[model samples]
Target: MVGFYNSLYNLAHTHLNDTYELLTSLQGRLSPAQTTTLMQSTSWDEIIFVSQRSPRKSSPGLDGLPYEILDILIRVPCFHGLILTSQPVRFGSCYRC
Candidate 1:
């Protein structure tokens, strides 16, 4: 059992490292324009639309914030302003809780 666990751990670690390396290589190969497009700041309308479309019972994220709460928060004027003014550093990424 101990050996099985060790082997599983090693396999997971190796897979994670390989995935990271592949992502890094792919990122390095992207053109400046492509990277810019990927990191483009999203619009409030787009966010609101996505939030509204999301399944109500979907699992909560790491922060344990509910999807319903996010849906409500996204419509707030201050939140819209913050998202509009912020710079995007990564693809499909949002502010951490």
Candidate 2:
């Protein structure tokens, strides 16, 4: 798992660094494995979205979802699938795979 994490870190070094810092400061008390899982499960897009929204406190939130603070728990990568929710756009629906 460390090897896999290392590979992912290499692929998204800066973003992963920011995520690691945030995770360390979290009060939720997630285990190391859980943290890794969260990182691996999340998408780069969601991370950026949350970071951007944090500063704005956008009204009604992005994509009609909950506030940006809750976005962290929405599960990375998963939120991308969720963005197309309640319609023809289910998980992995965009790729038609």
Candidate 3:
């Protein structure tokens, strides 16, 4: 089963070779000011706003934390600070696969 999966994965990966990115490309990019704005630390209000807007019944992610738990977690000051200052986790190009 593993061998079969690996063979199919390799075949699809070779055929795509990142052409998937091209298909999803946006027509334009952010201006320098817009980029800077986006890169700024997210405020707690922004976090709360986004969390509240998320679906209540959504499934938990790989970390097994649901949006409801996340909303609660952000209310803790230390946790909120950690979130604001934390660097995003970088994953390999094929991490999604």
Candidate 4:
């Protein structure tokens, strides 16, 4: 039983590492122009709509601001400008049971 558990843990750890590496490589291949175009083409209305669709009770992101705050921020014109000028977004690791 213990050996089985150890093998399972190792397999999961390896899979997670591989997935992260693959994502990093893929992101590196995206050109600056492509990223800029994507950011510029995104509309504020679409962002707000996605935010509205998010679960209200979900935990806050790295900024520690909840979805409700984000919803309010998206309504302000300056918020959209801030997002457009901000540095490229980074993804944080999430651990699940």
**Residues 26-78, model 1: lDDT tens digits:** 74487888889989877777777777787887733444556787777666766
In order, candidate lDDTs are 0.68, 0.57, 0.68, 0.67
TM-score of each: 0.45, 0.22, 0.49, 0.41
The TM-score of predicted model 3 comes to 0.49
Q: Write the per-residue lDDT of candidate 3 for residues 12-83, one digit (tens) a residue.
A: 557464667876685587889989998887787887888889898673355556788878767776566545
Q: Which stretches of candidate 4 lie over 4 Å from their true place?
A: 1-41, 86-97
Question: How do the residues 57-83 of candidate 2 rate in per-residue lDDT, one tens digit apiece?
Answer: 553343344456445544555555544
- Model 2 weakest 10-residue run by lDDT: 82-91
Q: What TM value does model 1 have?
A: 0.45
Higher-scoring candidate on lDDT, 1 or 2: 1
Which residue pairs of candidate 2 clash?
Answer: 42-76, 42-77, 43-77
lDDT of 3 at 48: 81
Write model 4 residue lDDT over 44-89, tens digit each, in one string. Answer: 6676778888988664456566788877766767567755454334
User: Model 2, residue 52: displacement in angstroms?
Assistant: 3.0
Over 4 Å off, model 1: 1-28, 59-61, 82-97
List runs of model 2 lying over 4 Å from the truth: 1-56, 60-66, 84-97
> How well does candidate 4 match the true structure, expressed as C-alpha RMSD?
11.0
Predictions: Cα RMSD each: 9.3, 15.3, 11.0, 11.0
Index of the highest-TM-score prediction: 3
